[model samples]
Target: MYIEPSYIFLVVPAILLTMYAQSKVNTTFNKYLRVASISGYTGAEAARAILHSAGIYDVQVEMIPGQLTDHYDPRSKTLRLSSTVYNSHSIAAIGVAAHEVGHAIQHNKGYMFLTIRNTIVPVVNIGSQMAMPLIVLGLIFSSFLVNLGILLFSGIVLFQLITLPVEFNASRRAISILENEGFLAANEIGPAKKVLSAAALTYVASAAVAIANLLHLITVFGGRRDD
Candidate 1:
């Protein structure tokens, strides 16, 4: 099966858009975080406060070295924050920290999407790593292998689609906590929303690219079967 150049064209824009959205969100979040006052609370403190308020005392908030690498690890029940957010007394820092804490909340609440995502995590990891190689090799060899590749790549697309709501819900919970808990003021909500919204777009672009690539692969390989 011949790979279509059109698929490459389709994915190029999505790749660029995802990169641009990521950079924009990082820049915007950092800029606002640097300037927004947090009423004397640091990011770590804010995260702890949020977790405590949510009755999640077992989750540990740890400082990790890196920029914008913060995430919640459910396995270890650790909320890892980058150095800047871990210690900063800024709105962006609080917002980001709370966002990660939101995941812990989801875990505690038994959120269905989170559960589903966790269940598929291993499959997505393996499928994503293997799909492209399988597809390319199959295309170079035989139609049967090509069909298998497409099926594997379809799994990747499904995983990306499943990821969308999980991320968006986390952001929504973060924003709500910031507002209800008074971590962010009215003036600060706009910037926080921008940061989170921009961040969400990266996921959207990723899903779109995955779907487009899968479609392209199917078009090429499926056509061969028909012929």
Candidate 2:
């Protein structure tokens, strides 16, 4: 039950940033959600238009129930829009929808970072799920397990690091598409960009938290070994 100073110095700030990021995204999205786009295209229509414009006709746009649960399924070539986004003609909806289409475009073109991120997804998944448990058990049992767990946890950090560019690229693409494609008016573009930017902050925050946790683990456990 030994507490590491690094936990307070590293993990706490990361956690706070994550909370702020989450709150910012929600507030920004909701604020723009009420402002309907001048183009009158729903989120699903915007996604489809962006895909088609990218010459990616194979990706299907589907509506799913949830708030901010939108995602692109690269394997199935499907872009799923959340309930809040699917039928909404708001600037926030179009920006979020276009962002998902950016992923589709990345998939279609085999964007290098996205490809690399997808490639190790299975391993990262397993590593993330088992890392904490392994670490906890190792504290009572074996240093070897502790080391192995830290190695596994490192994959999570790596994944998040790779994800930074992917998410930022998508947001940039979203903003460009919204502006160039006339999805949002000149004045509305700023708001749309704000929505996407806020969403991107969440990814940054997540990466920070992952790195902090990894550092906390290494520092705490490494100190234990030295003793």
Leading candidate by TM-score: 2
Q: Which stretches in model 2 have alpha-carbon errors above 4 Å?
A: 223-227
| Local accuracy of candidate 2 as per-residue lDDT tens digits, 1-227 | 86678999999999999999999999999999999999999999999888888898898899999899999999898899999999999999999999999998888888999999999999999998999888888889888778889999999999999999999998888888888878789999899889989999999999999999999898888534522
lDDT of 1 by residue, 190-226 (tens): 7778878877888898898898887777766654552
Q: What is the C-alpha RMSD of each candidate to the true structure, in Å?
A: 2.4, 1.7
CA lDDT scores, all candidates in order: 0.84, 0.91
